[model samples]
Target: MQITVKLFATFREGRFKQADRDYPIGTTVANVVDDLAIVPSEIGMIFVKGRAAEMDYVLKENDALALFPLLGGG
Candidate 1:
């Protein structure tokens, strides 16, 4: 299956803002995160096809996944 990943905030640092990634069937959001070298702790929110999604959420072909990093500010 092919998924489109969008990165936000620090998540985009050194990485692309968006990308098209291919994965085997039954792949989950966590798999893509790991493949991108993004630690789970760094993730604040995840959206799959514009809806809030869990890390374990299964990815479907052509799914649009967005990742947001934990934000810190005074």
Candidate 2:
């Protein structure tokens, strides 16, 4: 299936801000992250279809996913 990924802030600095990728059926968020080399340090928040999603979340065709870099606000 194909999915859209959006990167934010520093995540976009070192990675793809938007992309369309293909994966086998039943692929999970973590699976895609790994495939795209999206390390934990590059992921601040993750959203799937406008909602927060866990790493184990499964990705569907045409899903709009966003990954933001973690901000340190003290």
Candidate 3:
């Protein structure tokens, strides 16, 4: 199984912001976050397959996953 991941915002400075990586099938979006050693607070938005996805979303091979920081005002 293989997954391509894209990291944005502060996540880029972490040890898991690689453009792509390989993980076992049935990996959830949250698993990817965990692999990156990312804390929940640092995580903003999650886009799976071009749509807003929850952490429980089961990731499929070749699925495009994107992570971004939560938008804030002021």
Candidate 4:
């Protein structure tokens, strides 16, 4: 399956802001996170097609995923 991944905030450091990636049919959000070496604790949000999703959420072909990192400011 082919999915579009978008990264935000600190998550984009040394990585792309967005990209199209290929994965197997059963790939989950957690699998992509791990593949990108993103620490789960650092994730602030996960969205699939503009809707909130969990780490275990299974991906579908042409799905768009957005990952945001925890933001801290005063």
Candidate that scores best on TM-score: 4
Write down the TM-score for model 3. 0.85
TM-score: the better of candidates 1 and 3:
1
Task: Give the candidate order by descending lDDT.
Answer: 4, 1, 3, 2
Q: Is candidate 3 or candidate 4 better by lDDT?
A: 4
lDDT of each: 0.93, 0.82, 0.84, 0.96
Tell me the tens digit of each residue's lDDT in model 1 across 1-74.
88999999989899999999899999999999999999999899999988999999999999999999877679
Q: How would you order the candidates by TM-score, starting with the best?
A: 4, 1, 3, 2
For 1-74, candidate 3 gives per-residue lDDT tens digits of 77889887788884556566898878999888898888877778999889999899999888989988887778
Residue pairs with backbone overlap in model 2: none
Candidate 2 residue lDDT tens string, 12-54: 6667779988888898888878887778656778899999998
Residue-pair clashes per prediction, in order, are 0, 0, 2, 0
lDDT of 4 at 51: 100
lDDT of 4 by residue, 1-74 (tens): 89999999989999999999999999999999999999999999999999999999999999999999877679
Span of 10 residues, lowest total lDDT, candidate 2: 8-17
Which segments of model 4 are wrong by more than 4 Å?
A: 72-74
RMSD of 4: 1.6
Model 2: residue 28 alpha-carbon error in angstroms: 0.9
Could you estimate the TM-score for every candidate? 0.92, 0.83, 0.85, 0.94
Q: At residue 44, what lDDT does model 1 achieve?
A: 92
Q: Give the TM-score of candidate 1.
A: 0.92
